[model samples]
Target: MTLSYRVLIALLTPLIFIYLWVRGARAPEYRKRWSERLALQTVPVQARDGIVIHCVSVGETVAARGLIEDILRSYPQLPVTLTAMTPTAAELAQKLFADRVYHYYLPIDTRGAMARFIEKFAPRCVLILETELWPNLLAEAKRHGAQVMLVNARLSAKSLRSYQRFSWLLGPIWSALDLVICQHVDSERRFQQLGVARERTVVRGNLKFDCQVPAATTRAAKQWRTELARPILVAASTHQGEDAIILDAFARLIQAVPELLLIIVPRHPERFREVTSAAQQRFSTLTRSSGQTVSASDQVLIGDTMGELLFWYAAADIAFVGGSLIPRGGHNPLEPIATKTPIISGRHVFNFQPLFDRLTDVNGVRLVDDAEQLAEQCLQLLQQPVQGQTMAAVASEEFAAEHGATARVLADIQGLFPPPNGQARTLKMILTSNPNAATEIWFDDNLATAVSDDYFAPSFWRQKGQIIGSATGRASAWFIQHQPQNMLLRHYYRGGLVGKFNRDRFAREAIVKSRAMAEFSLLLQLRELGLPVPQPIAARYQRAPIWGYRADILVAVIADSQDVFKLLLQRSLTAAEWQSVGATIRQLHQAGVYHSDLNCHNIMLDQAGKVWLVDFDKCGFRTEGEWQQANLQRLLRSLLKEQGKAEQSQQLFHWQQTTDWPHLLQGYEQA
Candidate 1:
């Protein structure tokens, strides 16, 4: 079956290019990036041995944003390569992640292209968002020993029957999946009916429900609302046939409420001009890209801009989720739900029928049958603000209840990446021994070479002219300028008065119980939990006869970051940044991590303003208890103590107890 399918794709290769050329006539971006489409581009060194996520179009890309961010936070050490089929989705991925992730066009699903892609990236895992299943792509990844999983997977009965009709071709492809994280139980059953093993499928809720309105987006929406004080109706992701119906509905809605404004956003970028032209034929229209301020007399606005759909939804008093007025199914209604906006949709929502059904059950969305009903619903919602608010409240509650899918999906993805020392084919750790000195070294196998005790010696780096700098604490930590990456080497030392007598010595213990080994293992566990922490490079223990053993560990430096203590000394953190810090701490606590010392010094803010927790020397997992609160209090005391010292020295410290602490707490509780 696979052979026949490949033969068919090979035969249609020319037609595929012709199709692309045809699409390029309407949207020129389709003709761009042919090298990426053919898997002809060179993979960067940093992107190798990482994870590849496939989001077919803009909707899938938007839905997968939360999941991708969680993946990045959990495995800060691993690079992520994002691939999309459409130009809009490609552009959206770039705008969303910027330089944080590698973006590329997914290679056409051919044997040669798939092989080159898999070999170049050498990805350890491939995650397919939603339902983009290509036979050769899955087979090549599996052939190269990369785990493949389908996330936010949904298969309606219609799609299931369609796949079942060609079971011979798709059965093996379905079986190739390491796991299928479904959005509904019905989807799980459909996948099982096809070919997936029961053990390999689990039903996690929809990721769209986990979508968050960014703080910046909320602020922008607030400004927009203040600018346009009149009632606003946002028609989002409209399709070709649906725009006419929506325009007709707006025509009728204006008779009842002349001050109401309609903002229509087309689903595809190529249709933006067409939709804008159509809306202008009926009412005074303004396109968002025109940079023209909207007047009170303007009744129509075209949201032609990309990546501002959420902002429009937030600014709207009522949202009409488009594509349903015609037979094109519908876009995600959860976007408006996340923004606490009332929703109205047409009857045809089979693409997300289960979700729509659930929302309808709770009176969260009003379903319309035609233009007449759509206008009626819009007028009713506009006239009765309290009714609209009540509906929005119910939808928001349901949306909030569906949270945690991102966490669940992260857990499943983490399961695919086993411990470095485990028998996982993806990552491996090497243990080198020196029987002569009762010494041992544990290091990542991906390192250039197997490290020895000499690698731990400061003199080893100093002799090679690799020592870049040093930091003062109870013991000094030396920074090494290693090729392709930087490293920090720290020797374990006893703190306080005990450090004066025996700075680096410890009682004899088993190798696994030693400080270096324990910390190394804990770091690995933390990475698996998806917490942002320094990557452990190598750890060693050198025996000192009867006295005990001395330990040292080398970890990769987090690039472009400073400890919060250092950042606060220079400038005050924005309210959002403070909240992010609190949210990050909450994530650690939720993961059962008990940082022996949770202080401002241990918290880091990267150049991108991502919060990171470091220095887990004595930290370990603990059961849920009062220690979480105590841990937070410790961080607060550290902030206060630093502020006091700075005041005495007449130095600047930018922390406010009332405002910043409350914002932090808000972020913590929300997270």
Candidate 2:
């Protein structure tokens, strides 16, 4: 299927160029940057080893603004390359980001073009917005070992059926996606049906809900409203067929309420003149770009300018989101919802059907079938100001409830690219000084409060009546109820001959290189790689005496779990359970992690039988080599030693060298 796809695309390359040339006749911007579209231009130095984000057009570019800006702020050292398929989206990106991002036209999806693109940019990760799944683009990116993620992804029922029809070609491509951050659960389910693994898909809510309405935009809207002092209806992002219906509705609206003004904004730039002409035939109209004041005689205002859709929604008493009156799947209604403006739309909003349906259920949006219904809904809202205000308030509340998607997305992105090995802090980790003991503490800000020396002391938790339990190991570990979570606190102690003299103190070194700090940092990196390791809460290094320091770490405790050694002593594990344990170890090895001590004592199983590895006292990342196999052999030795002890004690041992080991090896090899 892929071979045939490649051949088909190759044959259509000339026609694609001709289509671009034809489009350039009406929109000349398409004529420029032909080299970029063909992947023939030189790659910018700053863009290498960075991130690439592809937004198909203006709407996607706008939807991705918050995410792109957050990525730039979070990883300033890494450059970002923004690609768009249309001139409008490219122009918007350039205008919004300026030189902070490198802008390029996404090349045509020929194998050669995509290969050149992947080779040139060498992006560490590729983020595709919405449903723009180009097979060659995905293939080349994966071929070069770049993580490919689908951001703000959505799939309508219609789109799902269409994709299913071509499953032979798209199945592998969809299944290969590293992650799909969906806007809705419905989309996630559709993607799963189309072959995306359930574990790889997550519902992050809609990125559009996280869109911010700037204070300056609000002030401008207020000023415009005060000047007009009349009820206004904003028909925003109107498609061709929808504009005629909206204009017809406006004509009826004026007969009942003569003072109401209508502002219509078309979705595409080329239709601005056409929409303006259609509006003028029925009523006195003024264009926004003309710099002419809208008089009482002029009942229609044409919003032909760019980047002011939010402003229009904010200034209106009622907003009718366009594209739904036709089969264009509606523009996003969250903009008006953000501005606290009542919304009306047609029933063909399959693109955002879930959101619209929820809004309709809450009386936040009114669905109209045609010009008559659109006019009736507009007149009702315009005549009854309190009703419109109530709807707006409801919609605003719903919008507010969904506002943290940008932060969630940023958190996930942080997980994708952990900081280099020696960096002191992850993006969410914070450092603070403990004045009591002259200590430095590194903690995850999301989990911990202000850290002090007392946090490491069991006496503090005991005094607070928060200590829950204690475990005896080479040293002692205290488990405590830490406000919102259960945490395990362990004080560092030397083992072997070294432990005889210096049990708790060691030579002073850089705080980040201390045993507690190193393990905490390694756990953070491992978690980012999606490993099943304990979450690091906090790590502290306290100055003890001359040239020495005492270290301690606090980590979240896995609930309802027992060590594999203990579980095995209790009863025999199924072959499937053994296979899962092997797969978990293989996953860690694949991430280039060296577990340092991979023994039965360190491996655990939760209530659900999920495998987890713990105790990273001396573990760190290493280049792939024989060490991975050696780590497995060490586990095997531990199992044999335990079996020998069990035999000597006349106890039942669950593991068999020939049977269990083979299952583990099969899982490891397959994984």
Candidate 3:
């Protein structure tokens, strides 16, 4: 731990306690177990060797509930301890898993407290929800040989900047993690920027999206359908100032349609009474907690109950999710989406921007600004039932589309355990980095280079013989014939948006993050898994004075082989050949390989019809799920793109539909 951090924690520890005490004034649960929060009340003589999961607050508690339940259901043999930073989280966790999980208040991050907590749990693994960067807690757990994982992780730009300021202090804490399950590609990028290795980070999607509304919630929603007025609007999770604007909008909407009902759910329970008093001045209102049934005569409903936001959405014809109206980062839309209720969102939704983007792009969500715009938008959805239904269908479809991430994450959890047959490799390598810059080169211990670091450079390959040339529409590689082995040397070239600026430039990165170096390491792992792939001989890179670098990797080539793309144009692939292709890819998938750019050209066939996958650049292992279908779809698209130019090419590909496609899918299914 950094001395400055320790000193800061020491200075602020009293204020932290004060803050907890103040919170306890509103909700006494925070005061009930003060000792547990300090790690002073634990008296267990023996530690439980299972898993410990930490959730920071209510949002995190909700997100992790599914994952904890999954762990209990799937791996009931191992004990579990759940810890929360806030009393609300602790109470919710206990309620969710009262007998199933051991629930406790997480201790502060002092070294002694963290060490004591670690010792008490003696957890086999520590899985923390979201981006909680408790340095002492993580470091202590890791020191005790616990596998530390950051699950459903993400970082906003603001958070990233804040973390970068103290990166020197926190880099080691991040490096201590054995695995990091990121929410998306962007989160993976941010984590990588923060000194995380590509191998350890996996984009497993956000678990919040994986949540299912309780069957009780769905069943209760149905009963609410008959009570509310037509075109009823729910402004769920409304913050301080947002209620007035939504109420104003509802007032205007009421003018357009005389019988409209608006149910406003304030975000905090403490504000429920205050908001209800203010709202009653302009409309006929009733509080949800009053044990009074709402009717068409009631122009407004104050949702004062805790955690029935779903039922309110289900009761309404239209739902306007509130935190979006003001500066408060938006609440989740999944609750409304769960019931296929039409949604109206205010312009701001940075918290779940990607989710909102997917919704609004398809008109699944109607974005509005202040009172008038919200009134107009809500009126539009209310009047046009077809439009509402279409938006609702697409919104539900979009939500359904994000579902498979849970299974993929579970696969990653299973991957944490060692192989049944002890097939894991004890990989050791030689690594050297530039002192002047953040660049590194890695090579297998058995391999070494006599040439300079530029051995894999283009000039070196051009001076030697070349099998692949520029005319192939890819001037990226050259096949070299050597005494001991034939190797394919590929110069790293950028793809996508960044490539336009500099095709061969990469921001000088750490040892494990270098594209060429990471790929080389992965190929070694793939080869050991007995997959048909090239052997990596050497990899190296050169960093510039300031930033950006070029790199390359040399892998032993498969001789006397032709890519499936090339083979297809020459002749139709036999059914056996197609089956072999499916079986070959499945072998890698079973070993947890995620070929990011799986294409017909990547798969090769030799004289004996043996198949091998090559060009494993920008690829790594991922928890397998819908991605398998996506991979197949990408290969199919690649084949069509490659062959669509001519009927002769088409006939060769189309011929396989009857024989090749069927057997290929069958082989995959069998595997």
Candidate 1 off by > 4 Å: 418-671
Clashing pairs in 3: none
Top of the candidates by TM-score: 1
Query: What tens-digit string does per-residue lDDT give for candidate 1 at 590-640?
Result: 998899988998898999999989888878777789999999999999999
lDDT of each: 0.86, 0.86, 0.76
Look at candidate 1 and tell me the lDDT of residue 538: 80
- Of 1 and 3, which scores higher on TM-score? 1
For candidate 1, the TM-score is: 0.63
Model 3, 1-671: lDDT tens digits are: 68778777778888988997887776666678888777877533122546788888878877776777788776554557888886656666766777677788888888888887886666668888888878899889887777888889888778889998986665467888889899989888988988889899999887887777778877777766654426678888888889889878878888889888788888766577778988889889899889988776888889876556667887778988888988887878877887789998988898888789999787799988899998998888888988888988999988786786667777787789432224322123343434234444555434444434555666765666544543143455777766477667777888778778778888865544578867876786687667898888777767755667778887777878988887877888888888898888788888778898898878899998899998888897676588878888898788767777546544554434556678888777776
Candidate 2 has its poorest 10 consecutive residues by lDDT at 419-428
RMSD values for the candidates in order, in angstroms, are 19.8, 14.4, 23.2
TM-score of each: 0.63, 0.61, 0.58
What's the ranking of the predictions by TM-score, best on top?
1, 2, 3
Candidate 2, 292: how far from true, in Å?
4.3
